[model samples]
Target: MERPQNMSIAPRIAVGVIILFHAVGLVGLSLPATRPLFLQVVPWHLLLMLLTIVFGHYKLSGRFKAFILVVFWLGFFAEWIGVHKGWLFGNYAYGTTLGVKMFDIPLMIGVNWFLLVYSAGVTMQRSGLKNGFVRVVTGAGLLVLLDVLIEPVAIKFNYWQWIAGSIPLKNYACWFLVGAVMLYVFELFNFKKQGIAAPALLITEFVFFGALNLVIGLWPL
Candidate 1:
């Protein structure tokens, strides 16, 4: 999706909320005093972000809606395989922080996947890159970069834990491959210029995790 030209108030509001939430989240997560409360609301925060992205734009096209369903299941199933068989992502088990699990995997994993892939798609789509495959590859690479920032913090915060007690190289490799597959599917669709919410969310995620990683660096490993 592309950023809508002449964006209305909703997109601006969405952007504001994105910045506000991440800033608050940064403060909340970094400080020991507020960490537990913020951690408990992680799932709700995700839902709110989804709402902000969805409602910030007009009604979705049928194709885009279909795309959403496909990506959600793709993400969940991929995670299922990873969690159960140690195939896709790695041998990592989720903790309670992300909330309710299905088949021992958090349902929110799919939502997280959709949000990240959608945001990455929109961010790339808005770019000047004219090649579809290149965009997909670049977006996949972008996700891998974000994952680099997210992994250690995620492990520290109990989002998921590696079975081996250390992140493996295969984890990042699989992330790029799985992310590329999803992004390739994203490229198959022709979505309209929607709103700024997608890219804003993506950037906010990077900032949020990036800050967390920096803060976590201060702790003894």
Candidate 2:
């Protein structure tokens, strides 16, 4: 079934704003003088990204809406457990960089998860993979790949800290497990394609984190 022609000026504006915001962030974080200030506003950047996705995909069906809620709470609960019990994603603790926290879990963490999973799911759907299992695996793999780029930069920005100065293998394992389940739910809903927003958001985040990782890895300043 064809997706409804619900496209409008709003998503375009949102994408433009996101591009401009990231452009500034890339330039600002590259400079030592502005890096600290940029990092302090990371939470707001995250919020804007979330809003951009919401605005872009505003015409969601009922099932898609329910999927979003379920994925969000799943992500939130996983992080909550991971922080307090060190069970899900290994021994990791949130830092002040991601802004406010509830029970030591950053609220933006759940938002970030939903954003990535949704984007990745939509991206896989566009891949023309007819097999649901293949789509699920590939989508989850994409999420893990993004996490690879994010982890180092996240630690450098003090978004979270890992024990023993290294990310544990368990973290990635749990990410795949949770990501696969989330993608499965996404596939179950069989949502109509929204537009380029999902792919754009995914690629933007990938580039943003990947560039930051490369810069920080090389300079280590």
lDDT of 2: 0.84
Model 2 per-residue lDDT tens digits across residues 50-87: 77777677475577668778888889999998989988
What lDDT is obtained when candidate 1 is compared to the true structure?
A: 0.87
lDDT of each candidate versus the true structure: 0.87, 0.84
Which pairs clash inside model 2? none
Question: lDDT tens digits, residues 47-163, model 1?
Answer: 988777766655656776788789989999999999999877778899999999999989888889999999998889988799999999999999999999999898998999999
Give every collision pair in model 1.
none
- Model 1, which residues run further than 4 Å from truth? 1-9, 219-221
Largest lDDT belongs to which candidate? 1
Looking at candidate 2, the ten consecutive residues that score lowest on lDDT are 1-10
Best-fitting candidate, scored by TM-score = 1
